[model samples]
Target: MPTRDPDGIRRVTDAKALSAMANPFRSRMMDALKVDGPSTASGLAQRTGQAVGSASHHLKVLAEAGLVEEAPDLAKDRRERWWRLVDPGTRWSRAEFADDTAALTAAYAAEALTLQRQFERTQEWNANAASVPEWDAAAFNSQNWMRLTPEELGELSGEIVATLLRWSQRTVPDDGQEREPVFVFARGFPAQP
Candidate 1:
């Protein structure tokens, strides 16, 4: 299903497990856990705008797929339950699911959903950009068309991820500078338009 890599990412390679995470609600829950750390179903429900029962069901599904796990230690009592991402991040490649039709379909769905979510988040940021003057200089988007061999593309992807990991793992300074979670995502693929 999902194997932990040396980079601490969960590489999902199974159709069933991938399908489990393909749901819109489940995807949001996973994001919430990744961003905010371990949380109860009620907390996730609030963050994701889902009902408590719906959140619990999706969390169980995600746990069954090994994408998330129960955080018993974070629970305050027997009635309380908490969940956290099994890894810092997840990665899946369409090439990995090329052989199975069902897997390919699931992969496509997950990719499309992710792209849509990213676009929506960016749109929200754009709409509210005027209110955050401090971030105006930092917010950015860039694109360039280039030709590269598949091997070169792979290497480029690896390098980009390495750079992101460096930033992601750095500790925030104790200087009390105002800091907030910043959303960052990247995609590189062959395209002509």
Candidate 2:
């Protein structure tokens, strides 16, 4: 239900939506929709281990915010409703902040913590799967020092993001075969003087 802009990108312009997703449960719900595909509220509760009522409430909130769409499920019981993510990569406009530095900071902190937790979980999974020889494992840890204008740095960031997208496109899931989840995290910023 989220509105698509001229570029075909769904724009999450609602401040409430941003704050709603700041919650861990809602964030997990979004991730579930993106990774596991469309599912009913009951299905999401089962996957996330959340109470059915809680999942249903969060789904309603997401739907109101245009983050998700309810699809009629013909395969399931006639009464059951299926929910799907409107846009897996939806983003907010800076104008939404409108000089509210405190709100913006809080939102950024919450997002950072969520991403950190995800990375930690993935690392734990990788560590536990070390005995599995069939699992593909690779880790790259390195830093670079370079001098560049702001424009150059922005370009570099775009190139890195594009490369990662390409990698994701090349990855194909094995049907009915168990495989390790691959997690990639990169943090880059100017060094302190």
Question: Quick one: best lDDT, which candidate?
Answer: 1
- Output the lDDT of residue 188, model 1: 90
Work out the TM-score per prediction. Answer: 0.95, 0.76
Each model's C-alpha lDDT?
A: 0.87, 0.72
Worst 10 residues of 2 by lDDT: 132-141
Q: Could you tell me the lDDT of residue 57 within candidate 1?
A: 93
Q: List model 1 lDDT by residue over 40-61, tens digit each.
A: 9999999999899999999888
Candidate 1: stretches off by over 4 Å = none
